[model samples]
Target: MGTGWLPWSAASLASGAVLLVLAALTLPPTSEVGQVVGTVRREDAAWLMASAAFFLASVALTMGLPAILTLIPAKQQVVGLVGVWIWSIGTIGTSALAAFLILFRATVRVIDISPTDVEQLGQDPVMTLSLLFVFGAFYLGELVVALVLLLASRLPRWIPALLLVHIAAAPVNHLLPEQLQGVQAVVLGGGLMALAVRSTEAWAALRAPATR
Candidate 1:
């Protein structure tokens, strides 16, 4: 790839990495996992809004990749968590890593909300709708990418079939409520991160195959 494509992907992935960490920080505490109990709703809104803001920014960054990486004129390159091994590990590999971290958090964030709290959330129309729309939608994007990665014939075989299974679950997740949603989020998120770590390393080995 050209110098420009390399930097853009790296920067976008870096920003994405920070967003994931910040997203984690914005997550509701374990104590409030399923409970409506909290110091104040105002604080929660602020955090969610902040995360949303970063999420929007992340989206923009992601969009810029295709153009910036003009060096590689490939369209629909594998964006897999594990499937990136098909391409030598590099910025492409890191993109897979960042993708996983982002998705991982989306899935697990809901476990912190309790069943009773979810019911209470239902009574509060604004929070209920917002909760359903925001979290569910956000997690859906994660699954979308995972699906994109898994199905692309360009993707490596290292990615297990399970990756596709979990990714396909995103839309189905919407059929259920928040309590179950959170569990689904964690499962998908964990899968993404795992794929990132291992794929990147394998890519590295391939790049320097002579060393091995």
Candidate 2:
């Protein structure tokens, strides 16, 4: 492989890292000490700025996968379109997460943390739909894409397993309370890292002279 693949993969990995941070930041509620989610009020210009950065980087990272496939050799791109759709699911998932923040906002909105609001927070209709949009697409799409890639002999073994694990974990995590979401966030973060690094592993394996 050319040195250009090095920079290409590096850029992809670097972008994935930044996007992972955004995913974690915006995914779970961050406590002041224990488990307090930060407010998303536009009153604080700083929060707005941070939110912008998080969404942009996350979306860019989601959208960037298509471009990345283009950079790779045609031989490696058999299931790449499906891969792009699969990656776009990240944007959907994180967007759902941002929308889920609205439930927390509603909690903070009331004069009292009413039982209704508390219950509602546990089961937000809007965020539920959002989660369905992303998690569903990603979940089903990953399986299909993985199967296709596998049949086509275009994907590494770890890629499908890693994605399947993440896809399966998503629904269970969404059922958790906002505070309990951090655990899910951590799981998702690790999953993303696993998917991101698979390419590097494949490259390394191929580079060994005995294989060649």
Candidate 3:
């Protein structure tokens, strides 16, 4: 890519990273169905809605990340391509879930849905199957992308290491106390931002000799 577009790409990545962290921060704590409904109704609607919005925006901005990051990989171009495809599928799954969350909140606000009904809906076999697919695809895709970056990209090793750590910790974070739930998102965000900064610096260094 040209120098002109480099800055824009980096900025988009950094912004998306920040939004990811913010989305995680705004997410509600998981609890009993009745408590979850009460939480969503009373104090969590705005937060949950805001979280969904941030997640959507983050996903939109980061959609190109796999392509951009893999552009200059040192080797295994085909592997990078495979990683991109997987990442794209995962992104689509995540986007669907986020959209569903918005609709879910809207439904709760407009209708007097019972907690038992909500609980039953959660137990639907179809929904359970879909959740399994979504979570599996998302985590697997992330791991593949991180591995591509680590094995092929020329960036510092620490960047991809951070991402690997983030991916490993994400599920475990959910098991932690509520206060610690978003830590993995923050770590992932930091890694993305670091990658952006390093890329910009490398591009600038390459241009410096030519400009001189």
What TM-score quantifies how close candidate 2 is to the native fold?
A: 0.54
* Candidate 3, 103-139: lDDT as tens digits: 7777888898888978998999999899778767666
* lDDT for position 107 in model 2: 45
- Deviation in Å, model 1, residue 79 alpha carbon: 13
Better of 1 and 3 by TM-score: 3
Candidate 1 structure quality by residue, lDDT tens digits, 3-46: 33433444454454444445444545344334433422425564
Worst 10 residues of 1 by lDDT: 64-73
Q: Residue 68 CA error for candidate 3 (Å)?
A: 4.7
Best by lDDT: 3
- TM-scores of all candidate predictions against the true structure: 0.39, 0.54, 0.83
- For all candidates in order, the CA lDDT equals 0.43, 0.52, 0.70
- For 14-118, candidate 2 gives per-residue lDDT tens digits of 475565565555543533322233333323343443345455555655644443343334664666666667756755575555544444555455544544545
Rank by TM-score, descending?
Answer: 3, 2, 1
Which regions of candidate 3 deviate over 4 angstroms? 1-4, 48-52, 64-72
Q: Which stretches of candidate 1 lie over 4 Å from their true place?
A: 1-6, 25-28, 31-122, 157-212
Worst 10 residues of 2 by lDDT: 33-42
lDDT score for candidate 2 against the true structure: 0.52
lDDT value, candidate 1, whole model: 0.43
